[model samples]
Target: MWKSRKSLVELSGNLRLIVSHARYGKANFHGSNTHPHNRIYIVEKTKSPDKSYIANLSASPGQKVILRPGHVYFMPKDQTVEWNFTPGVTFVAFHFGLEIFRGIDLFDGDSEFIERPVSEDFTREARELMESSDDLGHAVRLHGMIYSLSGMFTDKTMKAVEQARELMREYAPIIHYIEEKCDAQTTVAELVDHFGMTRNSLSKGFAQTVGVPLKTFMTRCLLRKVTQQLLTTGLDSKQIAEELGFSSEYYFCRFFKKHTGMTPKAYRSDILH
Candidate 1:
């Protein structure tokens, strides 16, 4: 079922999941009169289209564009677009709310639109699965399709982010050493020796790329580890503190509360409840 703007409730709640697999055989104007709520469209065509457009932008076949089938097209609630469906064009489309795709900075415009062709095999299997199901089975098939489509974008985005993160990964040995010897009160000298860089150069490069002082980042990482332990394990504050290389449980509690605005115990309680 195609949803018009008037009946949208998914955007208000910040996220929604839409799943469908079908063929569009007629020419129709999508989003001609009203904007859909925040949504991502994943469409796979059984037959090739002559042309299509999102808003005023045009898409051609096999361009590695962002919104192609097996990929995602994220758009805000107030944006407008048009689709010119060629006859015999069979496609599966999925819609997701904007919140579901928050923090992904792939598209270059206000509307998160990416259009490119996807692998024919994947598209065929997805379409087949959707076609052979109904109700809950259809829902399951659609969920799987969404999962696959989301992963495609996520993998691409993560690769881009990972390029920026590689410098930090290179410093992983030092970071791990610090975490291990936190009680021994490691110094910058030790990190410098292990990484074979002058203190000044190391600090400058880390700050430029990671946007945090090395010491500050180390402390944050340690604190995060402690927080996870507190939440997931039965360990007390003291045990967590000691494991994270904190000088004392009181100091750890104070540090955690300072950064997180809640005591570790309180945070754990809130999460659990």
Candidate 2:
């Protein structure tokens, strides 16, 4: 830990950082509606996995980790990971835009799972101080917490699904095309024609490998793109909706509110604030 209790304001310029303190057990592992935020989680009270929800994009097939107190985990932005947690687990999670650290490279920007060991004493103290600190001070504390795990970054002690890509090798070109045309006025029927496959074949094939139905995956991608615009662009809802290929602005608002708890304008306000 850095000994100086310096102001965190300097380290956190233009950083949109938020922290969540939570306890969970006996929780079903709901898949994440993955977003563009990179995340950091630190364990406070590690308990049973039977009730402890543990899921991530990096966990290998049938691979799982035994949660231990004093461990910290990192999730890269835009990865399809599970955010659910099991019961009796106390943890603090931090989420921020990846671009905030784009120049620093403190954490792995590409890996899905990064774990590091910290002393339980330090973890508990950091959590308490982080919760009590004022906005700027709180950010500094979080930055310090990240620094404690810096050794893991230097050591490369991360476990990612290195082989998962090989399994979906067949859909490599198709997936790339879909992503590039994600906002294009494209439909599944058109996709089927382009690939010379039936709807079920493409959808099922993608689900088999991507863990999400094809249409659902595409919808999530579109919504994520819309979210970025909502946060960063000045385009009105109607214009943004049409650009993303929605049937109408009304439908776009409903879909946006469904995926995100707030309407587009509200979401933008909250983020900007």
Candidate 3:
């Protein structure tokens, strides 16, 4: 059953679209808050938040992440989600299997990057389009959104998925090694010595399996380490650089700018304020 339409739901018999308009009262929630609808959900946070507004949701037993206002989360259906929300948490949820693009990039995407910051106006428009009785229009809007989001992943950039778990396990020692040495000077030679793999093999194999070069991956780990310091601690750039084994503050700024396209000070200013 093939059809020429921008919307997957409009293709007729390919998929079914279900919309749920729900709200959560500000309360301390525990245990399973399960719903009967077993389909993918595109959740959008409408309305504005006052001070100290935060919500926590878990897709698994031990993993929890925050859900803030203006965050759009594309959640899979299989997750056992427990959510505790701030006062007046409204959700516009779309439920659908999205079977049309069975071979599309969603299957290869990582879950950690699910949430996106959408403008309030965009969320309102999507909510209105979804709430309207026009099914095709709603389907089209949802389809476009999914397409754009999934398009963010490519062969070179997609993160570790379930299928790559064995390889991830195999490289666990190397990842751990990188984690331990990310704050200091790390090189492929030292990594190869520790992991006992040749330079060429390690370089190409890690990139192919992990979707990024080992050097690049270690640099990212370092970036995360430094970024956390920049956010949480009151240490200045020079002190942080010295403690992290950088030769000088100038080199630290260069490294941060090379990786993130912004200096640490600028990033701290933009994020903290």
Candidate 4:
């Protein structure tokens, strides 16, 4: 449904949201881990009759949030959170990413985790999404559920999102080109030539506007594609490296580990499990 407000339409016109992993069952995770994508959990039961919680080690050494039944909790990407759950806890969990510009995450710099009570309307829609049998219908419902849940956590980032939407408009074509070239092992010099801009201008402009050097953004674009394949496909490291234009499996593993702090195999196993 299209909204009447022009600002709303323009701001969200290029938004991209991907829900990569979702699961529902008894809470079975323990220990600390970092994920490269955003995550949300809807609590159904507590660890005990009391004391249902997870600690955000990134925010502080031992900051904990109490999980209440019917509450939705969000943990930002690339941050470590410690899970202290018992068999009695259960949840519906989704791991997803949201971007306002190509490769630019909406919650890019957020380190704090947040929680809010699930609304009646959202819970009803989630039920419908779970019951849906048609594949396309299920995907649509699932995306809607994630988008709605995302709204609950965006209060801190809303202003930044709006600012980014405005700042990145002039560089949209460059962003899109880099995203398209992500699988090709593209380079900053290639972007300079293709865009017909001098090295200095291209580098300075991109860094100023996007908050990262152009080369850094290119690396992020490649990392995003690599992680997406790792999450969604059965391709092994060698195949992924060959398909994405990496020189070799060893180099690909090094690059992935250098940027993400884990090898592709470990990332896939940790997230999938």
Per-prediction TM-score, please? 0.41, 0.49, 0.46, 0.81
> What is the C-alpha lDDT profile of model 1 across 1-65, one tens digit per residue?
98675423433243334321123222333333112223344455424444544552323321222
Best by TM-score: 4
**lDDT digits (tens) for residues 42-121 of candidate 3:** 33542434422222243323555466666666554323455454444555544323222211123322333255676778
**lDDT at position 265, candidate 2:** 85
Candidate 2 stretches greater than 4 Å from native: 1-160
State which candidate, 1 or 3, has the greater TM-score: 3
Cα lDDT for residue 19, candidate 1: 29
Q: Among all windows of ten consecutive residues in candidate 4, which has the lowest summed lDDT?
A: 123-132
The models' CA-based lDDT, in order, is 0.51, 0.60, 0.54, 0.79
> Could you arrange the candidates by lDDT from highest to lowest?
4, 2, 3, 1
- Candidate 4 residue lDDT tens string, 1-273: 955877667767768997778766666557776677899988766757556678887785557888787788999986777876777876778888898877788888788889889865665556555555759868887888888888878764446677777888889899989877666468778888998999999999989998878887787677778888998899999999999999999999998887766789988877776
Q: Model 3 compared with the native: what TM-score? A: 0.46
Ranking by TM-score: 4, 2, 3, 1
Which residue pairs overlap in candidate 1's backbone? 66-114, 66-115, 67-114, 67-115, 68-115, 68-116
**Which candidate has the top score in lDDT?**
4
Which ranges of candidate 1 are over 4 A from the true structure? 1-159, 165-184
- Tell me the tens digit of each residue's lDDT in model 2 across 35-93: 44565667777456544444565445523445566877776654556545655667666
- Indicate the residue-level lDDT of 71 in model 3: 62
